[model samples]
Target chain A: MPQEASPHIVRSYEGELRRLREMIARMGGLAERQVADSAQALIRRDTDLAAEVVRRDAELDQMEREVEQFCVRLLALRQPMAADLRLIIAAMKISSDLERIGDYARNGAKRAIVVAQQSLISSLNGFERMSELVQENLRSAIDALVEEDAEKADEVWRSDEPIDGIYNGIFRELLTFMMEDPRNITAATHLLFIAKNMERIGDHATNIAERVHFVVRGEQVTADRPKGDDSASAVAGAPR
Target chain B: MPQEASPHIVRSYEGELRRLREMIARMGGLAERQVADSAQALIRRDTDLAAEVVRRDAELDQMEREVEQFCVRLLALRQPMAADLRLIIAAMKISSDLERIGDYARNGAKRAIVVAQQSLISSLNGFERMSELVQENLRSAIDALVEEDAEKADEVWRSDEPIDGIYNGIFRELLTFMMEDPRNITAATHLLFIAKNMERIGDHATNIAERVHFVVRGEQVTADRPKGDDSASAVAGAPR
Candidate 1:
């Protein structure tokens, strides 16, 4: 039988867990900022800020590698059981989600730079609202993970309907712009992709929320997530 | 100190590892078929096949859950060290990648249904070719994981450039189509997204290959994988 761990070992293990949470918190913070900055860059047509968002994506990639290395080390050395093991696994998965979130922001920023070059065709209000909602959900999801609050995570999970609703509106409006004038095609296409990227960012936030819920409750979220994005099968053509 | 494992425990542990590989192989086969079928459905304008692809995505999701639960159980019971531990971690990560690939296929299938309703605007030959390449890469990546062949994984990692190359061509071609006629706008837009979905599925295949490389070599593919997708920064205006 294994002997009881000394107080020193126990304290050190606790510190390591605290450090893991801090790492995730820091990573989540960077990802959230990336999403916000990318949207601001698009709405403001600030290519400089967009370039910054693109440049900062490398940091998130590096952070994910670091988090995975740290988790693997914890698993090997600490041999954590029960909740700690679950938390470590959750950290690895969340880091992957956050990295993907960063990639979407970066891709949006890249397109934002391209969009800045084209004449504006449609109101960007929908993009702004969509971005804000996605950012809020991402922030709440991260907070839920750090705080170990399943209810907060559940709220974020249930709240993605509004983001999808905004995305649907944007999809139709952008298509209309393209149909009205061919000149709008380039700008509208990039904007449509940016809007889609924002919607995907929201989905990643929901994925993070689900992971957090699992960590806190030690069970999967059984309820079917409410989905509102119906633009997938949408069809539109030039007015007859 | 723990006693040396008996023959039966040793044999059972090895059997468990074999079972894990088989599970991954099965899941990977299903994902590859989904990609192929979705592409074929679009090219053939077969809405029935597209709907079937959409319906089958749930199986990949369930498989991902099963893979994770099994990996967690192994981690807890086996406390596997070194290569065994890395393999389990890789399995979890790869399953997530596969699940996302399934989602892309399903999304593409949904868009294909809409595209089928509109008159075909351009040759879907590019789509068929792109889908074939992506399916090949996904298959090779999974085979690398099961066979523990780092070189095969590297080949898949390095081969994604052509998929992105084709996607860039499709992106510009669709924009040109939209600019040519207002009626083509709707179908072209949906085709643009389907092409993008295929590109993303290819990217996920590269991700799986990278994970396999890590599992085999115990280190990441350090040198940057070549990237050819420049559509994010592409800009095109209506021909003056």
Candidate 2:
């Protein structure tokens, strides 16, 4: 077994770590809310809510840095082992996922900023559905982390397929809207970005779920998900 | 200064790490080319090339896993130090970025799958140009890592704004196309996913650039990009 830090120190660190975990979870919760709110704002053309989501992101940024520093310091000072290593790594990965999710929310807000001004798209149907799926995934992924539930992590992994299907559906539908009316182009374009952003948020949630699985099971569950593989030809100067 | 690992081990490990880095670089290179190829496939409607791009992604996924395993073994046995720690972490981040870039390529290909069947959307005029910018950012981000060029990293960071602008322009144009002609929706939808894929690729490139900066500078540059602020929320939990 790897040599761990002082027991008492580790104990205290555990307490601190729990707090850190909670903070990260809280931050994730806030980001999730932001994404939902932003998506809704886009649907309803609510400028105030969109701007609020944008402003709140700065604070999230500050908190993210702080969390990373804490994780690094814990690594340096405590030399956390095994499950601890997994947790720290999970924190890092989940944080990255959360941050990306925040970007999606903010992007949704920005699109809301632009699209809200003009005529709203009549069918925000798939967009709404996609947003809800992402939110559910985000919630479950974090809950899996909190509970250390490998089962829950697996559930999140399986859920990604349908999310993609929805995104694909939205992609086609939005195209129909954009293709039909030049006047509808501006609003439709913003809506498309919003849909893609929501899809990505679901993807990130899936990523976090992967991390959560790794943390709990000590095996990579992400292998079951879609991963990029066009890299083998890279070594021998093979034609890309 | 941090203590070094066993010299003989370090030397061999260094060689392995170098090889690993190169492999990842090559992977990055491949993923970059695939992005370019898929974009070209979309423009040219080469369905066969798009299919080939999809088939090749499996190899990239395998390489990514290989790099991760190699890094873990080195860390476990070699117990790397500061620059080395940074290097390993950087490799991890780079590999992840490379893998995601590959995903974008597949994404592009998938869109091409649809676009290949339909008549080309006339308004997707600047797509190739926008894709080149995204591809350039991917190339430079990898170069920044290879050369340890902080300035190049910064350059990559700055370059993303224009890609965003192009993406915005594309979104609007596509919307306009759909609005003008209902017949254009099918091709237009495929083109939009392609655009979204390209934009996602650009974001992943920016992620690599950010990771390179972190490796070289040891400072988190997460706050600098003001686009959507996605990374801060999911992982920002405070240590309780």
Candidate 3:
């Protein structure tokens, strides 16, 4: 097991690690909320909520900057080794991923603004379902990071397959909808991009999971990443 | 000006920085080749080449690991200050971006394999153009890193507008083709994703540019990012 720091101090090596964890936890909370709110905004066509998501992304970005500076200072002053070093590095990477998750959420919200201006489609359901899974994976990934639980991280890694499956279904369905009417093309395409963003968010969550596994295990995760992306397997012209 | 290492030794701090730069350069070269080859495979419908791009992604992933390890080692050993520190962190970020670009290329190749089995679209010329631009920007971004030329990086950052414009144009053209014929949806959709990937590659390049600026200036690039994404501005409902 790795040596984890106590969360109750602020001066020594352990205190720094504790602060790092806290910053990451805070960033993760903000990121998770962004994902949830962005999805909710898209589903309800709540442009105001989407705008709020866009505006709040700056907070995550600021948190990322702070985490980076803190990690650098810790690395510089503490010159930690072994698990502590790994933990610090993991903190940097996880913060980057969470910041990116924020960007994806912001991008989704931006698309939501455009999407809301268009006529509605029933297919936002796919987005909602996909975001739910992504949000769950993201929360779990962050929890794993905080708890340093490789098993929880592994579970999140494995859970990406279902999200990919849902994405593929959404991909084909969106194309069909676009083909049915050009009017649906704009909204459908926006939805496609939103789904793609969620898919990427899921990928980043898995990335965090892998990082968590690495920090705890002191080695890279060697298992093949599970993939269920069948959306591009066959051309529409090819025999199924 | 920041102190640069003579690329001749390994036992000194500057030598470590030089080695880090060399690794990043090599990784950047591999990533660039992957992008070029993936686009080539798509254009020629050469599944073998596409497969090669997918296979070669492992090299970039391995390179990313090496770079990460090297950076962490340098940090733990040297505790570099100012430019050196920024450069190391930038290397980590750049490698991650390069790895992601490689993944996008591999994804494009995978889609190209399926696209090969289907009917071809002349609109692929747009993809060719977009990839060329992205490759150019990526090359310039890396060069900016090597030369520590923030001006060049800012230029590359500005250069993304044309790429986005091309992407938007392709988005519309592909949507038009798909709207005209349901049979075109599958291939056009794949092309759309490829275009989006290229757009994202361009974004990554700009991200590198910003990092370059940051590393050289010791501060974040404060200017607003230049964005000309017309993809969401108007629906396909507008007159061609």
The top-ranked prediction according to lDDT is 1
Per-residue alpha-carbon lDDT of candidate 3 for residues A13-99, written as tens digits (9 for 90 to 100): 676798798899899999999999999999999999999999999999899999999987887677788899899888988998999
After superposition, the stretches of candidate 3 with alpha carbons farther than 4 Å from their true spots are A1-11, A237-240, B1-11
Ranking by DockQ: 1, 3, 2
Tens-place lDDT per residue, model 2, A86-127, is 687568657766887887798779778877676765777777
lDDT (CA) for every model shown?
Answer: 0.93, 0.74, 0.87
Q: What is the TM-score of each candidate against the true structure?
A: 0.97, 0.84, 0.92
Q: DockQ of candidate 3?
A: 0.51
Better of 2 and 3 by TM-score: 3
Better of 1 and 2 by DockQ: 1
lDDT, candidate 3, at A47: 95
lDDT of 1 by residue, B1-240 (tens): 998769998899889988998999999999999999999999999999999999999999999999998998888888888899999999999999999999999999999999999998999989999999999999999999999999999999999999999999999999999999989988998899999999999999999999999999988889998999999977674331
For the predicted complex of model 2, DockQ is 0.20
Location of the lowest summed lDDT over 10 successive residues in candidate 2 chain B = B231-240
Q: Which predicted model would earn the best DockQ?
A: 1
Q: What is model 3's interface RMSD?
A: 2.3
Show model 2 residue runs off by greater than 4 Å.
A1-6, A123-126, A165-169, A178-180, A226-240, B1-6, B123-125, B220-240
- Comparison by DockQ, 1 against 3, better one: 1
